[model samples]
Target: MEVLSLIAGGVTTAVQPINLMLIVLGVTVGLFIGAMPGLGSVNGVAILLPVTFLVPPTSAIIFLAAIYYGAMYGGAISSVALGIPGASTAVATTFDGRPLALQGRASLALVTAALASFVGGTVATVFFSLFAPLLAEVALSFGPPEIFALMLLAFATFVGLGGDDIPKTIFSICFGLVLATVGFDTISGEPRLVLFDIQGFLRGIGFIVLAIGVYGIGEMLWTIEQTRGDVTTTNPKMTVKGLISDSKEAVRRGWKGTWIGSVLGFFVGVLPAAGATPGSLMAYGVAKMTSRTPEEYGKGSPDGVAAPEAANNSASTGSMLPMLTLGIPGSPTTAILLGGMVMWGLTPGPRLFIDESEFVWGLIGSFYISNVAAVVINLAFIPLFVWMLRMPFTILAPLIFVLSIIGGFAASRSMHDLWLIVIFGISAFFMRKFDYPLAPAVLAIVLGPIAEPTLRQSLLLSSGDPTIFFTRPIAAPIMVIALILIFLPALKLLRRKRQVTQD
Candidate 1:
């Protein structure tokens, strides 16, 4: 009943002409960013943050969130049409999406991705509307110990969920933790990681630079490796008949994937560091293991495309959980929003719901509107998007690279960011070849900073008693849940190995 009222109020606020227009505008821009390789939600939102200064806070946030979802839909197109994933979370989409495109079913792949995204996002958004307030209440009651435990859980979940080389993922996460230390020591006011002259480094590596490097530059390198083959030239014509066939196919193959992605995405999004990549990868892996036609995977199976796309989109909603409830960002893009929220003098977290009910609910309502708009827009634009494929990558590459540099520098107007973009571009290229996941790295960087401070505060308050983390009821249970989540994957892998050995 409480949730229904909030939803009612949210709809009312969202229905205002100005807000409605913003939703359409936000989705339109987000779609373009998602199509443009290497841009990602983090870079896209960061680039647009300055524009928000001239707009209302709620409107600005609504616009940025719309972009985030739009890009998600756009990424499917890139993966299916160009064989290049627009973001790390879409990596799994490449497994089957590109294959379908290669087989002259690109339109089917795109339509399926968009529709699945819509369903996953819509379901997750409804769940979010109902659950966020309840979760916020729980979060508001949390003390430092509980917060610390939750942060630990987030860290563990990401490390465990990431299917990449575990050691490298750990190294990247730890590197982020180190980078987090570059700023002032929260307790001592001491400059720890700064090499004595650069105050900007004292602010730590900006999220914008990291995103552009890992996503933008890294994407460029990945694209460069693929010998420019005859770009999936055949148009898999999408007609009303084709649409019906694809929708039926989506329902047939995507039901489980949708649920898996939605549920997993919700849990991961609640964690401060888990983010979308883990959700997408885990969904893909689970779908493959569960499928009756496992052999068809990675060879144009619609289920393969459906699963990851669902997970990635669902995870985008999930990523909002911690951001809204605990004031901790579950992803880099959320972190950027956190900064924007602070700048707007509006605190995020449990209190926001109580004090800014309309704003909070309006944002939630916009998710539904933007998602519907995304499907309608993409369906109409499929032919145009397909036509973009015929344009040469050689021309697109430099344009993308230049935009990345601009977006990076634009984040804070620091020239150092330009250098960071170049360096990250090189690093992202290598990481791609090495099979590393940048999402985990970025999530770690963003949340690691918040976690470390919380941990320190908890420890100090407890007089260095680590048991305080487990003694608190709410915090302890969350920690335990996280522990189970972390160990379950490993246990499953071990069981599979044992079964193989016995066979």
Candidate 2:
């Protein structure tokens, strides 16, 4: 009955005209951002944060979150049709999505991605509506120790579960932490790496700048470097046969991917730093491991394509849990939204539930409607979206480059920010050449600023007692969880390497 009542309350709050309009607006912007190369969800939301200054916090948050959800859908279109991942979370989709497009199933791939995302998003939202308060209760029991543990666990998962080499992953993460430490000694209020007072560097490298550079510029350069001869184009004519062929398989194969993705996405979403990329990749791995045709994973397996689509989409929803309850963002995109929330004078911690129950529940409720709306909107237009890929990259790339610059400048209204964009872009291109993962670096940039300060504050409050992190019952458990998460992935990596050598 309590759960039922909460649902009712959420529906009442979210069904208003203003909130509904915001959802539509966010979905539109999100789709455009997602459709474009080099403009991902994080960049999209970061660009929009300033606009929130003029709106109510409730509207602003709802709008930003909606854009993220919509972008998830848009990313699939790009991957399936254009052979370019619209977002990092959608990278897994490229393995099969692009193949399906080459086979003239582009429309079907888009439809599957859209539908899978909808299923994943809807399931997660419903779970959130019923389970948020319970999750909050669990979160409340956590202390500094537990939180630190959880973060450690989150970082470990990235290294262990990321589908690349463990040593490189570790190096990437350590590199991120080091980069994160460059701005200032948060403990002593002294600059550490500024090295002669460059004002822009004093703030450390901005996450958006880094992301646009490595992901956007680096990716663009990589694509150009690998530029092949004119490839035969696949025309995905929107046909009944295509619809039937795809829908039948989706209905048959989607259930497993949907459930697996939703669960993985939800769990990872709860972890502060893991976010949708890991969740989607993990889901794809799990789906492959459990599939009847496991060998078909990288060869355009529909299930392979379906799993990450569902996982990343569900992960996006899962990320909202911490954002609403603890004021901690589960992903970088959410971190951008966090800034918007703070700017609107709305603090995002637990008190938000009580003082802004309507807003909280309303935002949660809007997710349900918007996710469903995305399926309807994107699926109906999959043909058009897929057709967009026929446009030459030469034409598309310039526009995306422009958007990346605009989005970066829009973030702070500063030309310095724009220059920083170019710097990061070049850096990202070089990092790509070295095969370093940019996600960890970006994660560090986003979470480090918050985590480092919290660590120092907790320790100081306890008079520098090292055990203070472990002494807090809640914090200790969370820390323990983090340790387990980190170690398990490392162990798995070792076992896999041994197995490969033995084989």
Candidate 3:
């Protein structure tokens, strides 16, 4: 009942004139951004984060959350129309969405995606409202040792479940941690790792600088390379009666997968480093594996399209759970949001619910508003987005390039950051080319500062006894689990090798 009242208050706050306006505007911008191939919520948020400085922190977060919600809905548009995923999280959507388009059911696939997304997001938000406060209460008891153990668990998830090259992922994380140590020593108050004695290094490498470089400029470059070949799109036409029939058909065929994804996605997404992409893929696999007609999945089935589309949106909302309650990011996009919160002079974790009660609840409230706005706007504007896809990437690339530069400059007002953006962009291109996962690196940089302090504090409290991490009641099981997850891949590899030897 107490939680419900706070949520009601949040909804009241979100419906204020300026807040509502920003929600609609943010959703509109995000819809277009997500419909473009290679541009996802992460890119849209990173490139536009500096612009949020114009608004109050509460409204700024609302706007960004709306963009995130809208992006999840829009990614399916490209999958249905162009036979290509608008973002990596939507890749599963393409399996059935493209087939549906090829069979002239593109409008149906898209409508199903929109409807499933709505259901998934609303369900996840209800779960969030119910569970977040309880989690926050548990987190309030945490001290340095417990917090450090949680941080270890967070990185461990990347090693166990990141679905990337293990060596390269470790390397990326180490590189980001090294960067996080550059500016100064927090405890000692001394200059540290100032490369080449460059004055700019004293300020540290900002996460925003790296994020914009990787997602904004580097991703744009990668897309240009990928799209060198001509893309043939399916022409989808929708009418009022057609939409009505498609909606009914979508509900009848996709209801099961929608429920499955809404539940499954939220749990997966709450695990740090296991964001929407894996959640969607997992949902698709589960939905097909359990289906009566499994063979129908890859052949224009509405269930197939609905499962992934719903899971991705559900996971996007789910990713916010840890970020709000525990100060850990559950996804790459949330990592960036975490940094933005710190930049705004706000701390995450349980105390944030106390220190910034209005800000916290208001952002939570905007989730409902954003989800509803995203579905309505998405359904109404499908034809418009499909038409916009006809616009050339050759033209879009230059605009993103300019925006990335401007955003990079806007954050620090530094020529130094601009050069760093170019360097990181080129570096990110090579990293992606070599199949290195960048999310772990981004996450490491964001968590490194917080993790380092807690580790040092824990060590001091224990008189240099590393066993303190395992001795605490709350930290012990978490530490044990983290160690197991970290070594899981290596254990699997060794078992495989021994089996091969016996064979």
Candidate that scores best on lDDT: 3
Between candidates 1 and 2, the TM-score winner = 2
How many clashes in each structure?
1, 11, 0
Clashes of 3: 0
lDDT of 2 at 309: 88
- What lDDT would candidate 3 get against the real structure? 0.79
Q: What TM-score do all the candidates reach, one by one?
A: 0.70, 0.72, 0.62
Q: Report, for every candidate in turn, its global Cα lDDT versus the true structure.
A: 0.74, 0.72, 0.79
**Candidate 1 residue spans exceeding 4 A from truth:** 1-22, 33-109, 128-132, 141-164, 183-189, 195-200, 226-245, 264-367, 428-439, 467-503
User: Model 2: C-alpha RMSD to truth?
Assistant: 5.4
Ranking by lDDT: 3, 1, 2
Q: What is the C-alpha RMSD of each candidate to the true structure, in Å?
A: 5.6, 5.4, 7.7
**Taking the tens digit of each residue's C-alpha lDDT, what string does model 1 give over 1-503?**
97888888787777678878877877888888887655677777898999888878888888888889988888787677665566667767877887787676777788778877888798788878878766545435666666567556656655655455677777777876676677688779987787557766766676556766775677557756764433334664556787678778877766776777777666555555556766676676667667787778768888778777887888788778778777888788899988998999998877888898878888888888888888898787777766554456666566657766765665558776677668877987888788776655665565566678778888888899887777887778877876876676679889999999999
Instruction: Give me the candidate number with maximum TM-score.
Output: 2
Off by over 4 Å in 2: 5-26, 33-68, 75-109, 161-163, 195-197, 229-235, 238-244, 247-257, 267-365, 412-444, 450-503
Better of 2 and 3 by lDDT: 3
Better of 1 and 3 by lDDT: 3
